[model samples]
Target: MDAPQEARDADVSAIAALDEPTRRRLYDHVVRQSDPVSRDEAATALGLARQTAAFHLDRLADESLLDVVYERRSGRAGPGAGRPAKLYRRSAKQVAVSLPDRRYELAGRLLAQAVEESAATGEPVRTVLHRKAEELGTQLGEQDDNTGVLDLLERYGFEPRREGDAITLANCPFHALARAHTETVCGMNLHLLRGMLHGLGEETLTARLAPTPDRCCVRLDPGA
Candidate 1:
């Protein structure tokens, strides 16, 4: 089943309300859990007392960022068991926030520029985009597995869309930066992707800047 849209929106609002430290702790806890975490486990992982963990967990639950999936043994289950321990997991709906919103707006402008430039030059935008996408995909493929590459990309705000033998970056994480300084930002993205790919054991990838009237940027490719 899917979450109701209102509930999803509420979660986003709640996350936006949290302070950075609390938000970081919450995000880290959610990402690290392979399964629902018991209150005790969360406390231990965060080096907090059980009561303290419970407070934050409950707050997160109220915001719908977490869902109580089930009850579990507190390791003190007995013939006369007291309250059952609650296990918490991240909700299917995730909170979304664009920190420093100006940046995102800027990124949109930059992308528009790139698109416009391509159009003016009489080049097929899709063709140029696909070439760039392929370069990015090859760079990501250098990783041992798709998950590792995806994780790296996520940190940079580029979510990957995997197709049969290729991957497309669904979003540009640095939209604001890219738009404001196309050459610099695009080059940086290329360099960052190159380093990340190389660290994952790929040694035959290259990135080159391709200028379009709308946007000037680099494209990545597998070395011949």
Candidate 2:
């Protein structure tokens, strides 16, 4: 699935936050240390005012580039150890952006799951692949908080558009693979949408193959 615009925007903002020279330097220092660095330690190491170090570190934490923890550095017992000092460390969050919406990760996941399941059960690879795709689509549809099918499709980057009584999927989420293995990928696409329609209780709509030069391989048509 294509990463949501809001997520990509947040990632971009987080990366932009590090553009400040002092902040970037402070971040570099914090990540280099094996243990989390306290504000006072970072301030001394960077030759900055204590308050200035705190502010930049807090900003990094706010953007989720740094994680915050509390520790008592004095190595003493209750009430004598003094208050816990706030510390900073590199966050585990990963931020990535790709132009034109690459979903190689999702495709790889589906392919890997298909291979594993097929090996375990001795099922045909194609059958396992389609089943896995359909299951994933159903999970996606079920996660919809009562939104309509079109909304769900749009959220997952199917780019649904109306045409008379049907909804045309404008962008294929599996574009690269679809182009390479048209029949196999298109068949999986068809079943995935079918499962999505079922999960949404979409009695008035159905997914069908209606390939065109400019649009996705699947279309949603009115059910009889």
Candidate 3:
């Protein structure tokens, strides 16, 4: 329903498309070529039947792992010229998957925004970073549906686990960056969760920095 989920599903589908040997072979050959490949050429190069290659190439294009383009092989452009040949090439879409999920791109965007805005407004980078991260978290919270805070947290790869009345995040979505830049990143994370709760209209839980082994630096405590 959300972007992360949608992306994961698409990437999984694309990866699954390659699990078939013939499809994978066609995909590899197409990408390695300097130009888009025609079905006949692909089949000849791979020593596969034309029908077999065409089927696999179509499958790759369906999954968006390959892009299809129609171009005439002949240099002539007259009425008598044959129709354009359908060709296959690599798609520009990027695919990534992590065991525990990660949001490095999100952090990078926040950090970049902080630096650029700090330069423009003469505000401290740290101040801008926190503001931007919180704004983003709020935006995430404001998306469609009335999902619970736990659900929202999990969706964002926080891996939130309940401990009595409190919540501990078992995984940090920005783990590597947070480890490299603890103070700045942890502060950004704290404000992010704070704004998330604010946007979700959650008043009973407080997000605080409570670093622990093998978990996030921020913890959600219940009540005022």
Most TM-score-accurate candidate: 3
Q: Candidate 3: which stretches are off by over 4 Å?
A: none
Supply candidate 2's per-residue lDDT for 94.
Answer: 83
Where does candidate 3 clash, by residue pair? none
Give a tens-digit lDDT track for model 2, residues 94-128: 87766555566777888899899899999998999
Ten contiguous residues minimizing lDDT sum, candidate 3 = 139-148
Ranking by TM-score: 3, 2, 1
Off by over 4 Å in 1: 1-12, 18-20, 74-82, 97-224
lDDT per residue for candidate 3 within 1-224, as digits (tens), equals 87778889899899988999989889989999999999999999999999999999999998899999999899778898899999999999887788798889988999999999999999999999999989988887788458789989988899999999999999999999999999999999999999888878888999999999899999999995
Reference-based lDDT, residue 78, model 2: 98
Can you tell me which runs of candidate 2 are displaced by over 4 Å?
A: 1-12, 19-21, 98-103, 180-184
Candidate 1 lDDT over 1-224, as tens digits, reads: 12233544575678664655754595568657798888788888778888877887888777776888765465566676667768888777645666322225333444465478678887765444444444554555554454465465545455555544434455555665767776656755565565566555555544455543332244344562
TM-scores for every candidate against the unseen true structure: 0.36, 0.81, 0.93
Q: Candidate 1: TM-score?
A: 0.36
In model 1, state the lDDT of residue 79.
71
lDDT of each: 0.59, 0.87, 0.91
